[model samples]
Target: MKKGTELSGLINKVKESPKTLQKISPIKPTKDETQFSFWIEKMLLKDFKLIAIKEDISLKDLITKCIKEYIKEK
Candidate 1:
């Protein structure tokens, strides 16, 4: 098939499809909390969990403590 024909077909199909509006939830940040996300290696995450367990602290607390120490060192 020609590229123009394929493109027109795709456009027509898209035009025939129904559109829906989605309801999104708003994020509210607390006094001391904000949301962030990043990727980490599997083994590194396992090691972090293990260290947090050994220290008898929540994973969040462990991460916060490590970040604070890192900033202090810098």
Candidate 2:
């Protein structure tokens, strides 16, 4: 019975962790973005990630910039 009570107390503390974390860092505003996924060569993705890191931008941002430029040229 004592062990069961201690387990329930631990569970309650675990459930409260998210609230504590939210107080420390409020959630960011939602971005106008959606998930996009496609198959690419393994080495190509590795190179792309390296470029994105060097540019200090996200992979999605780099891809979006490229696509927008292509559309503008067309």
Candidate 3:
């Protein structure tokens, strides 16, 4: 198939399959919190994500809770 034909086919499939598309809600920041970004080791991040999934909490919430606990301990 030509490139344009292949692209149209994929587009039609997506248009016909609404169930395959998921709606993503935007995350709202708390009044006291602002955006913060940092880098972590790849393995560590993967482990944290797994823990969050197992706990049934969002990764952002898990990280926030961990930071609060560390601050309380110190």
Candidate 4:
């Protein structure tokens, strides 16, 4: 009876792990998710340049803004 209860507890732990991990994700992009444009372009960089030039904001300020938004989305 003890062995059977132990096995059931192990199965329950396995099932709960996926939901418990929802808040955790890698900081870097994954291998299979890669695309060609992901290498050639970055939205943060482009938006930083465009907003900096158009708004007369400093590049550093625009970059900080973009990074904050990116992290928020993640």
Candidate 5:
């Protein structure tokens, strides 16, 4: 039999044995597929922390605010 047929037969055999097999699906992040984040060193992070405090906002909130404001200005 062809490789595809052989694989399909094997899959069907596995499917026939419900107690011996389980299906799995991948879980993906919903946020923009192109979006990404990275870690910074503690010292640099502390600097942003200071900026955030000076700006009177949480670090996470500050990032959103800054980016939004930048986009608005542009």
Candidate 6:
């Protein structure tokens, strides 16, 4: 079968099964914590990841530690 034909069939199947697309509740973070998303320079992200790996900690933990230290200094 052709690519367009396959895609059209898939779309038709999805259209026929409207109930398949069920609404889901947003995931709640534990302990009232929230998730954050942001963009950064590629080089900066790469360096940050390397630092996190070297410290054997998660990226989130490393960021949180840095932010806490920064706030304390201020």
lDDT of each: 0.90, 0.89, 0.92, 0.74, 0.84, 0.89
Q: Please give the lDDT score for candidate 5.
A: 0.84
Clash-forming residue pairs, model 4: none
Give per-residue CA lDDT, model 2, range 19-48, as digits (tens): 443346676659977777899999988998
| Candidate 4 lDDT (Cα, 0 to 1) | 0.74
- In model 3, the clashing pairs are none
In candidate 1, what are the lDDT values of residues 4-61, reduced to their tens digit? 9999999999899686688788866666787778998999989999999999999889
Residue runs of model 4 more than 4 Å from their true location after superposition? 1-47
Best by TM-score: 3
lDDT of 3 by residue, 1-69 (tens): 599999999999988846756789997876777889998999999999999999999999999999999
Can you give the TM-score per candidate against the true fold? 0.57, 0.54, 0.58, 0.34, 0.38, 0.57
Each candidate: RMSD = 9.9, 8.3, 11.9, 13.7, 9.8, 10.0
Error of 6 at 70 (Å): 0.9
| True lDDT of residue 61, candidate 2 | 88
- Scored by lDDT, model 6 comes in at 0.89
Per-residue lDDT tens digits for candidate 4, residues 1-74, read 99999999999998874646358766896544433222425776786689899999997667567769999999
Scanning candidate 2 in windows of ten residues, the lowest lDDT window is 17-26
| Cα lDDT of model 6 by residue, 3-64, tens digit | 99999999999888456567789976677667789998999889889999999999889988
* Residue 35 lDDT, candidate 5, scale 0-100: 51
